[model samples]
Target: MTDPFFLCTLLWFALSIAALARLRRRDRQAIQAQIRQVGQLADETNELILFLDYSAPGFKEIDAFLLTDMPGRVTVVFHAPQWLFAAKAKRWERHCVVSADCLNASSSGMTPTRVVLDKGGKYRVFYEVPAFLKLWSRSKM
Candidate 1:
């Protein structure tokens, strides 16, 4: 008879893959939800929308919202995600920072021109990206 160990190991591997696939699908759906929400608010004009949360290190889950849907007319940058005072949030934050390069125009010396305070102690930074950079950023992204 064939060794049961081999069958058991194959079953374990299949289960692992299924679990991972489920997680990936969930994550993809979450990201799509984010994109859809902001996409509804975007217009086919020369306008920039900045998003953030109502807690410390806001812009917590949303880094940049880049939408190639409308191309130059409307571009969205979903800067990944950010931390939210929890372990999962911390991982999300790291993801945003690392993935935001597409639309994140900020440099070491740059700073926001205005700060918008939400209900909580958290805050949002509103920086006006240059007109030239908008096109360049969108095109490259």
Candidate 2:
């Protein structure tokens, strides 16, 4: 009787571990999906800007300002829908310096920009900047 009970307990433990592993895999997949979505959005935004025949004023002489200056003073406007707020919040919580400036533009109507020093070079995670001027202008009105 005792042996049977022990076997049952061991089986339960194994099953529990399998379930936990599955959950962890699912969580990882979800995080990867979010990362990809963010990348795609950034790319689309860049394409749209380039399609507009506009350029990042002043930084023209420099090549790839986004990759170089991103770790320093850089601005990212969040346009992900409301449903993605939780994900954005998670990122903000993970990144963003304690004294980071969070500024919400009066025109954008969205939450303030979540600024942070890209210590881990993760800004590369985002490869595009949307129509900052247009968005700002529209938000102001």
Residue 70 accuracy (lDDT) in model 1: 21
* CA-lDDT, candidates in order: 0.38, 0.35
Residue-wise C-alpha lDDT for candidate 1, range 5-66, written one tens digit per residue: 99999999999999999976664454444334444444222233333233324332222322
> Which digits, one per residue and each the tens of the lDDT, describe model 2 over residues 12-129?
9999999999976664454344334433544422211111111333223122333332223222333334445345435444222111112221222212222112333232222223
User: Candidate 2, clashing residue pairs?
Assistant: 104-112, 107-139, 107-140, 108-139
Off by over 4 Å in 1: 44-141
* Best model number under lDDT: 1
RMSD of each: 15.6, 16.6
TM-score of each: 0.36, 0.34
Backbone clash tally (model 2): 4
Model 2 local distance difference test score = 0.35
